[model samples]
Target: MSNFWKRAISGFLFVIILTGCIFLHPICFFVLFFIINIVGLYEFSKMARRMEIYINLPIYLFCGSLLFTAGFLDAYIGYRDGYLWCFLATFVMSIWELYRKKVNSFQNLAFSYYGLLYLSLPFTLLIYLPYMTSDEWRPEIVFFPFLLVWFNDTFAYLFGSRFGKHKLFPRISPKKSWEGAIGGGICTIGAALFIAPYLEGLTVYNNIIIACIVVFFGIYGDLLESMFKRNIEIKDSGSIMPGHGGVLDRFDAVLFVIPAIFVYLEFVY
Candidate 1:
């Protein structure tokens, strides 16, 4: 099969699994996110190791598990204690790094925190979002953020490839262009507006604004991940996904937008 067909089949299977988990009850969704969190953290730690910075894998995994719990199960509290726990995990990992005589630098510590910041934080937004809405409206609000990001990414890649000229951040991501960013934002926001009426009990104006914010921040999210790859001098974050790269590559926008959206909903709602 061609790479395109292989990717299509894999993407289809992923969507089917996601749809099944999300609709099967919050528990299923939580489990799926939990597994994703662990796998994602593993990929991150492996990447760090490549740089000769050893992160305590057990600590990172534990923190990721707790983050998944806090977001989905709410078996733990939200940002306050969850964030503290993550910091503690970082601290412990730093201590471990310190003991490894061969690796010692402020940069390594920063890298450890960056891994958690990149993966765990935004994931919290995803797991928590659905529960924030009224039961009747949860599904509408919950999935829209992810859908918006995906739409923005899809449109951006397609439009950019066809009509791109001016670079958005040439050093970070050469393929991305300002034209694509603006075009993608417009298209995804249009979709949001089209679907707004179906989201019963949501304020249309507020939701539109929120949708725009998600798209805006999501663009930066993609760039930030690109920055990481640029700094690391790597083509992709990982090769987990055939055509897509790693979990991080696929979720770069989510990492950028999720926390921002969570904050927006917290203050606005």
Candidate 2:
């Protein structure tokens, strides 16, 4: 099959599964994202090892899962102490590093925890997003950022390639341009206006603010992932998604955008 077909097929499945799990049942969403969380951790761990950047792989995976699972429990069950084990893992990690005597224990521990802080925490924040505006699990609320981000990304690429002149960030992502970003932002803001009514309770004003937030922070997340890939001198995060690359590659913007959206909604409502 052509690359275009591959991307189209996988992308279709990706959208269907995400929307299905989200709207189907809260437990389905939890189970699906739990797998995504673990896969993302595995991909990061594999990347780190490629550069001889060793980490306690087993501990890192466990802690990362614990982080997401804790957030899930807290959000679903209203249990507050789910994070206790996650906090305890840090101290346990330090002590665990003592016996193996790996080179640069500090760096090892730093990167180990970095995976959790960078990847896992952001995903955990996603679980709490539906609850930000409603007491119940609203799949529409959870899927808001995805819509804006996808709209912004598509237009950004379209405009970037055609009218792009000035680089947005030359050192990291040279292909990105101010024109593309502006174009994407304009289109995404328009989308938010359209999306407002479907969200039931949120006003158009709040939706516009959210679209703006996603446009700005989604770019940041993309660049951040680019920096990581460039630093490691790899083309993609992993090959799990064929044309989409890895789960992280596909959701990098979503990760960074989630935390920001969560904060904004929390403050606003």
Candidate 3:
């Protein structure tokens, strides 16, 4: 099949699976993302190795998984100091490097921590978002930010391909244009307004504001991932999902937007 068809089929399947898992039940949600968390960290580890940064994969994986578990349990049960213990355990990598006597121990240590902060922490924050809006698990609250990010990405691609004249950041991402970004923001905000009635607790204005946050930061997230690929001189993060890329490539925008939305919700309510 052609690339377009491949992309379309993969995108469709991804949307279906993600929507079903999010709305199905909280355990499914946890299980799905837990797997994603591991896959993403593994991908990052590979990338770091390509750059000759020898991260301790086993420890990183263990610590990252622990971090996810802590976040998940905290959201499902209640806040706990156990998360601090997990956070501290991440530092064990540094101590491990001290004993290994490797040439680039410090670099490995840094990359190990960086992977957790960049990939794992944001996902952990996502586990808490639904709980923030409601005491009980509400898929709608979880779905809202994702829906906005999807709309922004879709509109941006469409607009950029059609009428892209000025580059948004030619050095980092050549295809992105100011026109595309603005078009995406406009479409996403409109979508937010349209969907406001359906989502409880979030007013129309709140939705609009959240949409703006998603669009603005979402672009940066895309660009940042592009920068990572450019730095590594790779076409895609991984081939885990054909036509889309890896977990990092697929969820880069989600990763960046979730933290901001979480902070906004905390401040507002």
Candidate 4:
């Protein structure tokens, strides 16, 4: 298949599946993203390993899963002690690393914990977002930020391709342009306003601020992942998708955006 067709097909299916899961049921969201979380962890481990870091895949995945599941249960059940589980798990992992006897085992330990913090923590907080955004569970609240991101990305690409001149960051992402980022931000705010009423959680004003947050942090997330890939000497994080690269590539923006939005919603809620 042509690259464009491959991208279109896979992107369509991903959106469909993700939308279905988030709207279908919390369990569906949990199961689907759990898989994505694990795949993303593996891809991250692969990248870290490229730097000659020793990664204990099973232990790291287990730790990541521990954080994910515990947080999900807390959100799902209204329990408030999830952080205790996370902290205890971190301490245990650190203790185990001391006895592993590998040379420079601390690097391995750091990478494992980093995987948990970077990949696992964001997803855990993402599942918490709907609960934070609404008085009651609303799937639309869960999907709102995603819509903003899509708007920003789509318009940014269109505008950049047509009128791009100055590079936004030539070293990290050569294709991005200042014209695209601003155009995208403008469109994102408009899109947020358009959807704000339907959201029924945050006001239109709040949503606009969120639109701004998504654009700024989304670029940081994308660039950070690009730097990771460039340092590791690879194009995509993995090949799970025909054109979308990997789970990490697909979710790079999401990882960063969720936390920032979560913090904002926390203060406002």
C-alpha lDDT (0 to 100) for residue 143 of candidate 2: 83
1-269, model 4: which lDDT tens digit per residue?
A: 89999999999999999999999998998999899999999999999888888777777787788788888888888675766776787777778777777666878888888888789999998887887865456888888878888888899999999999999999999999999999999999999888887887688888988999999999999899999998888999999988989998999988899899989989998
Model 3 regions more than 4 Å off: 79-81
Those runs of model 1 whose alpha carbons end farther than 4 Å from true positions after fitting are 75-91, 94-102, 135-137
Instruction: Provide the lDDT at 9 for model 1.
Output: 78
lDDT of 4: 0.88
The lDDT of each candidate is 0.73, 0.89, 0.89, 0.88
Error at 50, model 1, angstroms: 2.8
lDDT of 3 by residue, 1-269 (tens): 98899889999998998899999998898898899999999999998888888888888998898898899888888867768878688777678888876677778988898899888898888887777767888899888888999999999989999989999999999989999999999999999999999988778888988999999889999999899989999988888888889998999999899889989989987
Ranking of all predicted structures according to TM-score, beginning with the best and ending with the worst:
3, 2, 4, 1
Clashes of each: 0, 0, 0, 0
What digit string (tens of lDDT, one per residue) describes model 1 on residues 1-269? 88898788777777677767777776776777777777777777777776777766776678677766655544223345655666576677767766766554566667657776778777767766655554432655666777788788889888899889999888777889988888898888888888888876557786777678877888887888777667667877777677767888877787778788788777766
Tell me how far the alpha carbon of residue 191 in candidate 1 is from the true structure, in angstroms, after superposition.
0.5
TM-score of each: 0.88, 0.96, 0.96, 0.96
Candidate 3 accuracy as lDDT = 0.89
